[model samples]
Target: MAAGQVDELRKRVNDDWERIVELLKQKIALGSVSSKGIAADHMKRSAQFVADELIKVGVDAKVVQSTNPDGSAGAWEVIGSKIVNEQAPTVLLYAHHDVQPVPDASQWDTDPFVGTEIDGRLYGRGSADDGGGIAIHSGALQALGDDLPVNIKVFIEGEEEMGSPSFIPFIESHREEFDSDVIIVADSGNWSADIPSLTTSLRGNTTLDVTVSVLGHPVHSGQFGGPILDANTLAAMLISSLYDEHGDVIVPGVASQEVVGGLQRDLDEASVRADAAVEPTYTMAGTGSLAERLWTKPSITVIGMDVHPVEGSFNVIANQTRIRLSMRTAPGQKPQEAQQALAKYLVENAPFGAKVEVTPLDNGMGWAMDPDAEATQDALQAMKEAFGVDPVNKGEGGSIPFIPELQRIFPQAQVLVTGPEDPKANAHSPNESISLSGLRNNVIAEALLLSKLGGE
Candidate 1:
């Protein structure tokens, strides 16, 4: 509200730093790994944990789940609200309680479920991905006490890591509980530990499954290899066709362009390489500024394929093969259209007339923030005050599919994306972490933003 009140809010956040970190540690230990398949016990417990914290901050919180198209109750979610004034504008704070699956905990430097702090960073599976986000919301609410100037709704999703398959249904099932004028998505990252950022754009994604077939049955490689190439080789050729000599995508109808906006600050090459752990010798893909190549332009990656394991392989000519390609589409392009272009290319350019079958796996839309919106401007200014430096507009290469869905359902809502992650967060990786500074700053920024939205 007032300058003095803002200072008091930040001081309160700093005072509660240890309490917030401890809460995050407890959340990490819950290990609510979200996927299409898993026991619901862990997720249910995770939602309760979040509800307990929000209740302490005066939110009326509860655990919920909605039925899917199959008439089955889907993933668990936590929804809460604190209405100080009904007439005041409402703000919805969003984050996920579920962490990514840890198929191999041995790869982590510490126990994947045990939150560990080292060199001012908290390391754990979901600490950066979204546990940090929960901490920010809880800590900020705790600081605001009963002085909140606006109504607030807290949404902790249980299936965000699974592309939010149950998210839209969850919101639609309880429209009144989730509706808000401003939605703050704490699921992305800052530009750096010292530089706060508001995520402004995201590249959408689509996947395809290409099946190449040559013969009806497997044949001896030594006896029938010359007549036609094996299915794996033919599949490889089709995969290669998606790229050109310089690694730029050549898929027809897929656009490749760079971001031209006020917030696009060119990235420093060395820093990005270090943060992404990109080897110096790896050939840079595409032709454009590194930032655009990552945030706006199209890129194709062979994520998976069905092939015989070298350890248990037989010397035979495979008759059929299936390959999965993950294509990152440009921000403004339609993912379904991109999927179509990819399927067409694979089907028409089959190697040696090999029978090809293309399957559309999945698709998600991208987003570009409207910088002129009142709430968007508020978030940027709040971040500047919290971090003591002007906040930068950032673009994310990854797609949070649920984001566009939120816009589709609530076109009037202003969505502002910001979070506690920095480049080194390593979210979804073995050594995931979040900087304590980012966590604290994000808490302060969110609290300030809520105050401003309430017309403080």
Candidate 2:
């Protein structure tokens, strides 16, 4: 395709940006929080709204009730497809309609459901995490009209915020419709607002529950505290053994690798601290550049621990305590292997002869995109043209967990991880938002990519 064709696609997107934002705002207002706590009917409303909007743009769309793990009905997901020609390549565009629960509405500057535009950012629960991705797909389809270069398949899951429990079954049931040459997952963010990114790698996750038993029965802290420690204290010691003084995962068996791209120079230590809201008084943990620490290194956190409530304090030390460890493995590492290693480490490192039991929770594999894939190159060129800057190769410290499933089902398809998010998007947090320019450019980029794939 000629550069002029891409320019025309950009122009078309710019013209449709306002309408796209309005539709996105309406979708955001539906407040499709995931089924973790919100009602299923609420998610269905958002799914149905997206289906209606896509149908209006001439795409065949529908709201589907996902099948739960136990064969029960689950949350609603939307799947839509528009095929121009069988000979043309098929591209599956993926997003999520669900938003994280607004556990505390008081933390938000604006209503979580109402899209509030301020200084070029649209702030709301789903605005950046995925509402913007939906807008890009809808706007691109509208701009392309009947002149599409490739078949478009849209997959919007309603439970991504909760780790997409039913994602594999949902896509497996509709395998034929989703059989595509490429997948554009719009769930990640860019390196920065000025630099567009194609996320090439994501860390995998595995969980382990460590329980410590220091005594057969409760003991008086005042009498036995000098010679014996409580299970809670022993549990803390076991957790601390997983990390070094510098907060690095020092476990011998867990592996780490250097990323394809070195540290992202666009982000400095200060910027990262700011993004994570780390206090200035605290020191950045681990070693290497910020990108390496985040993207390639393994990290372990004691997400939860069971202990006696401070308000209901007891003079006696508890016999047993449990702590949940959530570990993020590097891309290309086997999560099961790491989990085993973690289990062994906790058992060996138990302090004061405390009996330790490690139980496996779950292991979700990570994804590493092939940068040399044709679809990937097409996306990079499209993003460069649309954003007027060279695109960056990015890695996500967080794991999608479901992307690998998509690959397992369609081994030949190239996955292009693209999104409209930036550092300040604040996805899953209070005041979540997406930059308007970023959203507009993302729409243009997708249109450009489709044109490239279709050889327009």
Candidate 3:
């Protein structure tokens, strides 16, 4: 915990940069998508890979298997522990090893599964989403060597990207194994490439699959174009009705909350356009500050649709259309409440007397924590000391469904969400990457956090 010790730890992490990249590349090459059969096997290997790395740092590590909610084999969960002092407070470090499937490799600048470094940034599918997280934990522990200050528990999950279908049962079945005083989720993003951030809140999510039927079978467009309504057209109208001209959700019962005053980053029109790849001439939608719309309000997106391809020149009226709807709720909104509101709107607003059926797909609750808590103060101080700048408190628009669950399981534990992702990281998208400097700073901050929380 001395200045020289901190300097040495930073030096060690910097020296091991290549090794960290190699380990990340190895995991990226495994293709651990839970939906694929081979992904299960790859995930097991990924878990063991983490365990082995932890063991190299003198930690007791092992791979544990559990069943998915549907009674199928689930991805392996790795648990590594280093008990420097049993009396010290336990620190749990959390990260996921699984990567999302490459939807279309053609869209990427490089192979999505191959970790590539260009201009000091490592790029790949999982390179930033969580592969960086895995490396951060390993790098921090490795830097500590035999001088680790606290009882450390490292948890690497394999099914986070897949919505953690097995997480509830897995945690319930092994509650004691994950007991800790503080939990740090290394799966969020920094405010920017140079500005570190601590995520204070995460939005919850709900999804619905809707099917609309207007006719018994396909009919010639010319014969029934005016008199008979097509399911596809009706589906389009129904989806459009979910939003008003301002691009805000029109559902009546969904909730919204005001973000507390703080040093929030202003997401301007230019930044939004660049980040979203929007057309330069397009005008921004919604009726609030960009930050308010993005971080403190409900948003709806049409994720997928099942309809005839336009390339085939289908002039026939389709009998049915299926659509997938994904909605992100405000922090204080419950997923169930949002789901019901969405379902009610879709059902009541169906056009052309179409027969509609709405099926609930999944739901994840939002999470919020006090930024001034004792552990959070320690984290902020550590980050400031390590990065030489004040860390910003931010709210994530995306959902980490299991975070609230972890809070519920360990009500007394302080949750700290921090990571290496920046706006340009583009996690779960093509050309995902991470800044090497950011990774190094993350390792330093985490190491210092562990030391400080250990009462050093």
Candidate 4:
């Protein structure tokens, strides 16, 4: 197909941009925060709105009960419509309707639940991270009307912010309904506002809790200071030792590999940090591209330390302490293997004679995509056609545990991650927002992808 054909479609998408944003805001206002996500009940309502919209656009939509987790009585709906074309491969366009918890409401300028637009940007919790992308895909489907030529399926989740714990099982139980030639996870964002990116890999995550008990009771620091071990200090020292001076995770058995396309990741890191409002910290010593350091390597962070501080002039020594360790593993790494390694590391590295216990909290697998697949190329070309610019190929530092599991089960399906989100989307932060321009571009791109795939 000639690029002009795609370009025309792109123009049509641009024409409908305002309407798209309106629909997007309407969707965002529904508030579908995941478990521990920003707006739990609101998220459910937003998802229902999305289901309703999909049906209006000629897509067959239905809600699927998340059968994986017991006692979590919620449903995730699957919206789909087949493009009647023989040549194109079936593609599944995916997004999550969930938003993170909007804590510290006082810090936000506008209501986090209300979709607000200012200076050409749409501000809302889910606007950029996912709601924007979902809007784009929905807009594309709407623009195509009944002219679609390939099968397209939309898998929107309400549990992504909560690690998508229920989604993997939902996919497993409903595998037959989701059979597709390609899968597009439009949950991530671009490396920068200026650079569109095709995410190729995502790190996996594991959480561990370490509890320490030194004595039976809190003793006066001045009276019993001589002989008792300080559980807090010991815990701090053990946690501190998890990283080396070079910032490398020194845990034994936690494997490391050089990431691919490292240069882009360095750029991404700088961009991500700037957008995330991070203060400059010492850079770690690592050899390889930023992608390797981010996607292909292991990262350990002390998530939390539960310890009584010496506040209010307290002169007592606390008897127990606990810490939360969050570990992100590279793609192709086993969560159990990493968990075991962490357990062993803590056991061996702990302070002598202290009662130490390590417990695994959550284990989610890593994901790696086949970057050389045809669907990937088709999507890339479609992006170029829509934006008139080559998109960046990169990987995310965080993990979407469900992606790898989906790939493992549907090895034949092509997985692609592209979306309208950006660093400022504040996916897990306060005052989350999405760009109207970016949303327009994404809608065109998805429509172009649909066109290109249909023509094939």
TM-score winner: 2
Clash count for candidate 2 is 0
Overall local distance difference test of candidate 1:
0.87
TM-scores vs. true structure, each candidate: 0.89, 0.92, 0.85, 0.87
Candidate 2 root-mean-square deviation in Å: 2.3
Candidate 1 lDDT, 1-456, residue by residue in tens: 466877898899988988999999999999888773432887888889999988988899998875665667787889999998889999999998988989898899999899999999999989988999999899988888888888999899888887676678778778898889999999898988888999888999999888899999999999887887999999988888888898888989998655735635788888878876898898677677888888888888889889899998998999999988898898888999999988998899999999999889889998878878888878888898889898877788888888988988888899889898998898888899999988998999999998888877
Task: Give the whole-model CA lDDT for all candidates, comma-separated.
Answer: 0.87, 0.85, 0.84, 0.75
- Where does the lowest 10-residue lDDT sum fall in candidate 1? 256-265
**How many steric clashes between backbone atoms does each model show?**
0, 0, 0, 13
lDDT of 2 by residue, 1-456 (tens): 577777778788778777899998998898887845423677778889999989977789998888878887776888989988989999999988888778998999999889999998999988988898889889988888888889988888888888777889889999987999999998887777778899978999999898899888999999888778889888888787778888888998999988755544534777777767898789888877778788878999889999989997979988999899999998888899999999998898889778999999999898888867778888889889888999887788888888988998999999888887898988878999999988888888888888888876
**Residue 306 local lDDT, model 4:** 82
- How does model 1 score by TM-score? 0.89
Clashes of 1: 0
Q: How much does candidate 2 score in TM-score?
A: 0.92
- Model 3's C-alpha root-mean-square deviation from the true structure amounts to 3.5
The whole-model C-alpha lDDT of candidate 3 against the native structure comes to 0.84
Worst 10 residues of 4 by lDDT: 258-267
Q: List where candidate 2 sits over 4 angstroms from the true fold.
A: 36-39, 104-106, 261-266, 310-318
Q: Summarize candidate 4's per-residue lDDT along 331-400 as a digit string, tens digits.
A: 7789789989989888877776678899988888887766666777887787776667788777778877
Q: How many backbone clashes does candidate 4 have?
A: 13
Q: Rank the candidates by lDDT, best first.
A: 1, 2, 3, 4
